[model samples]
Target: MDTITTYLDSLFASLPDNDKTRQAKADMLANMRDYYRDLLREGKSEEAAIGAVISAFGSIDELRADLGMPAQATATTTQSDPTDAEEEADEDAITETELRSFWHMADQFATQIALGVLLCAVSIALPAYTGGGRWEGFGVIGMFLLAALAVGLFIWGGTVFSQQKKQLNDRPITASAKQLANKTTGEYTRQFAAGLIAGIMICIGSLIPPIISAYIPGFIIENAGGALFLAIAGLGSYLIIYVSINYSQLKRYAYATTAANSTAWYHDGTDDDAANYWEQPHKHHQNTRARQDIALFHQVYWPTVLIIYLLVSFLLHGWAYSWLIFIIGGVMQNIITAVIARRDYSE
Candidate 1:
């Protein structure tokens, strides 16, 4: 019993500095130690006590199960080929983890794309709807509302950025878990900053077209307001593009982190059964392929679309068409960019 307790203590001492894993190990060790000590207090000889402890404790696989890890084997009374059962269990559990990681990757992709589309829609629609000069008081109210919303978003994004940064800076990325933690922190911070800056710029740029129209000559001002609106709209569109690009890049890193964390946890928990999971070896290759695919799409498709849209709008010589085309193109561009962005990390 004393020997068993000493063995568990040594194993616990060798575990890496992961808070949840460490606490779990500590609790399991303490429980085993107490149980064995109680056995020693009975009239058993040390050899008998140690044998009893070994039989009851089983192996690391049993300890993992006792600690509430997902059971790797079915409870079959026929103790035939327990080794095969362990392999099957490992395969099942690792597949579940991989599926979870895949779903999480999809979620991360959808979120960034949705946000980008929303930003484009809001930026384009706000100026066009308010440009007609009919809703005077309502326009002022809407501007304030938009400003408030932008500020609120910025504050939330900034908070996430700061927290992630602190977590990253405090830790050393010397292991797989630490590396994942740092990568996640960096990605979150980048996305938050991109969204924050883009939102503020769009809000401010949207207001410029209306304000400048009230000050110039009627002939000069008519075209001036529309031209200035288009210019600011173009700038806002560019900002959305920038945000989408950065968001796509950041989301890729986030996927890598999630995959790494899952792999690390699997390796840490599974003693000899870790070889069954395919996540660790394939992760890097998958992410690299994803990045290359995204880059190819971005480089080949986006610029051609943007150029054609701009050229057609210029040749048409109608303000309404120009405005409509710009708005539609901007929104479409953002959506396309967002979709491709997820592929950046898919490799």
Candidate 2:
């Protein structure tokens, strides 16, 4: 148990400092450790336990796929001696240099996210201010500016998306990796656009009703208008979560693609049988199946929430019940998605 714990610690310590990556490594290590410990408890000897652990670790290809990381170098250089595990641990500690580099990259990403939020907020708010609280006038300008901002954000997001995809597709495969990459990239783009659309819809939906009520003489938009806006806001929030999850997956795909390509390039033409490209060990880890499953789940999940909201509205108070259900469903969906993501991507 002591030896296994030490081995696991060293394995995790060597991983890079990105939160997702680190969590993945830790989960993998923990799973591996438990498997080995179980074997030992079943009367396996030290030698047998070590061999079993190594075998269960599987190929680097499987690890990369399961952990949602890009393929790196092969396992051909792995150490066999149990003592070497401790040594690997000692060498795994992050250097100051590596930490600095990681922090720099993180800072840049944070800045970009902040800027995106600011742009979106300003774009949505500008029309209301310019329209002087008039519904019709505000709606037109808001739609234009919001749509423009959405397009701009989409373009920026697409650039990030492409870069990530290229990273994954660095090596040429027998069309499978490329095909998978293309599909995943397309899905991600659509999800992002959906999020932007939802945001625009929510902002417009919320503002328009209030403005209309204010302009009309006998109309009371406060109750119904508030409820509609709330519903829209709920939908918009769900879209944000939906987009983020897909984006994260896209990033993982990119990393995996890059790693697979690097591995393929390293071993190029080493054997004639390996020339199939897609059949290569590195390419085999591509998660086309998993991505499809996630996409299908997302499609159903959002619509389910919407339907529930609508049903609740009809069964109870039209406006009030609808918003209540929408808000509740949005919160629940976010929680479920977070759990699934952790389970799927972690180790």
Candidate 3:
């Protein structure tokens, strides 16, 4: 039995290592052993039974057809081995420089999120300062400055994020290495928690001054306290946004790298012989297309909402209810995204 299994292993050496090949090997080896045993029971000598079994096994060519192997792999070696090559390519491992680059980009992405929170904060404070017909000129000037800063930060953050994405798409680091970094980087998680804590504290602390000002009974003091409260809330929200977005991007990069590596292996033609190009590769591309479509929807939808908001608020002077458009658009966006996701999954 040992001798027969050894010979079977040698014969199977050239075949792909997959579920089908494994099962076929087991079936063939079992049949060969059974035939040998039956020959012995029929009064044949050991040597003759062995020789008969060896002869009956026939050529590797016939075995290949029986096992349903590809015609190109006729020898004890494949033209290209995806698994071996991929493992070799990761020999250099991930460098500290690559990790540093990812962190920098994550910080930049976080900065953009912070800027958005700042914009919201400024907007919240602006009306209180500008609306009561007091210091109207300075209030307008402050509003413009904050708005300009917010817009500038948003643009800068977008550019930085784009660069970060391009670097990932280029695959500067291996997927395994990225996974390792994510595991080792306790700082990302710590920072996320710290940011959340600080944001919550500031938000809670900001309420104290307003509560005291409520008893003072002066418009200036009360309004000042309200503005201070809004500012504090905005800063807290910004901190939360900054940490959360950066953490999410870190996760996204890790997953993207892993998926890309797997896709590359599958495309190498040796890793998955059981699946045709369409069954696996086409489905991946279909997912990519679905994501792109959803992204396009967001790109178009948000700008349209902004345009609608500005036109209605400035031209039609419907400031009170114009904001509902955003709520409606958000609901529609969610529905559209869900529909797209479901349709892709179904197909």
Better of 1 and 2 by TM-score: 1
Off by over 4 Å in 3: 1-99, 123-134, 170-176, 184-187, 204-208, 215-220, 257-347
- Local accuracy by lDDT, each model: 0.47, 0.47, 0.60
lDDT score, candidate 3 = 0.60
Q: Report the C-alpha lDDT of model 1 over 1-347, residue by residue, as the tens digit.
A: 45775776665454455665566555555545544565566567778766755554445554444333555432331243433323433232323233335335434443444344344444444554566677645655655665566455545654654454343321111123324434654756666567646744774575566565666456335544654554455455555544554444344334442232233233434333233122232333334445565567668665766676677777765433344454445446545654654554342
In the range 167-247, model 3's lDDT, one tens digit per residue, is: 545243444455556674455778767876787687667676677778766644766776777777677767766766666
Candidate that scores best on lDDT = 3
TM-score of each: 0.34, 0.33, 0.50
After superposition, which runs of candidate 2 have C-alpha atoms over 4 Å from their true positions? Answer: 1-143, 166-289, 306-347
Q: Cα deviation of 227 in candidate 3 (Å)?
A: 0.4
TM-score of 1: 0.34
Best by TM-score: 3
